[model samples]
Target: MDWIVITVLFFILGLSAILIIGTLVSLPQVGDERKNLIKMKAQSYTFAVAMGYVLIQLFKNIYNGSNEGINPFTFLITISIIYLISLLFFRKKYGS
Candidate 1:
């Protein structure tokens, strides 16, 4: 029942909610070109998220050898935020 644990759970649930909502939303009928563009954007964002995870792991390995002074919860939150922001930005740029 620690506050940190609660916060992390909340963030995880919030992210899950957002993703579920996004998937459930209807896409506009667009031309093939626009659809391709959106697909490319989604792929790029997915790559960004993967890279972010790798970089975060590398950081944790280098700086937290003793596993002190580093909070993994914060890193998870940061990754989630990065993913959400990129998703929103890509959707805005290509979804319209």
Candidate 2:
């Protein structure tokens, strides 16, 4: 198997586990308001980034005149990784 495939799979699995754990166990020290802010901001950014990624992929495919399709899992993992990082950033920035 190619290293790229292996790396992508590893990241998808590892990030998923971290996301699930993060969701199940909310940060201990943050207040509800701050947590909400963090979630909302992260989600907003994730949405924008995901849409941009889609557009870029669409344009690339069109320009290349290829029939290739975007991998849904790859898209999910990309933006979820972004969301998770943004979540951590906001948590630290707004955290006590």
Candidate 3:
């Protein structure tokens, strides 16, 4: 990967981490109903972002004719990171 792409990816990941941490920190102060609503919205947003990222990668691969299949490790890591982040948010909000 190019240096610019890597840099941008890191920037995005950092922003994501900040957002997740901020949400987690604030979740406890909210009421239960509001917290559940926020959790649902957060999960939907995370899913959308992850799907968009994967689709972008797929398109790039098609354009570049890189037959090297998607790395399972990277795919799993991306998904698991998103899952864990949302899980943290849910746990903090709902005590689950």
Candidate 4:
């Protein structure tokens, strides 16, 4: 609930929006199969990144014995940022 966290969340969310919108606008009309493949690859990469972040946070919390707890909003924002970046990466890497 800190102001810094809130600010960061908004900033990252804005970046995500820009990336998604820019990618959508810039992308050429591709086939559905290609689109689906890009999406699948992005999602797979995002899932792995999300799991890694969560596990690291979990262990850090346990090891530190802190009651600060994990911030759900931060987690969501992190995942969204990762997913968007991954999506864009795949699109650019595989686009014709």
Tens-digit lDDT track for model 4 on 22-60? 776676576878777888898899999888887888899
TM-scores of all candidate predictions against the true structure: 0.51, 0.74, 0.47, 0.73
Candidate 3: which pairs clash? none
On lDDT, the stronger of 2 and 4 is 4
2 versus 4: better TM-score goes to: 2
lDDT order, best first, reads 4, 2, 3, 1
Q: In candidate 4, how many Å is residue 93 off?
A: 1.4
Instruction: Give the distance in Å from residue 43's predicted Cα in candidate 4 to where it truly belongs.
Output: 1.1
Candidate 3: C-alpha lDDT: 0.68
| Candidate 2 Cα misplacement greater than 4 A, ranges | 2-11, 28-30
In Å, residue 7's CA in model 3 sits off its true spot by 26
Specify the highest-lDDT model's number: 4
TM-score of the candidate numbered 4?
0.73
Q: Write the per-residue lDDT of candidate 3 for residues 1-96, one digit (tens) a residue.
A: 688866766666666667666666666554777667767766786788788987988899899988666665456556646855775766655653
Clashes of each: 0, 0, 0, 0
Roughly what TM-score does model 1 have, to 2 decimal places? Answer: 0.51
Each prediction's Cα lDDT score?
Answer: 0.63, 0.76, 0.68, 0.81
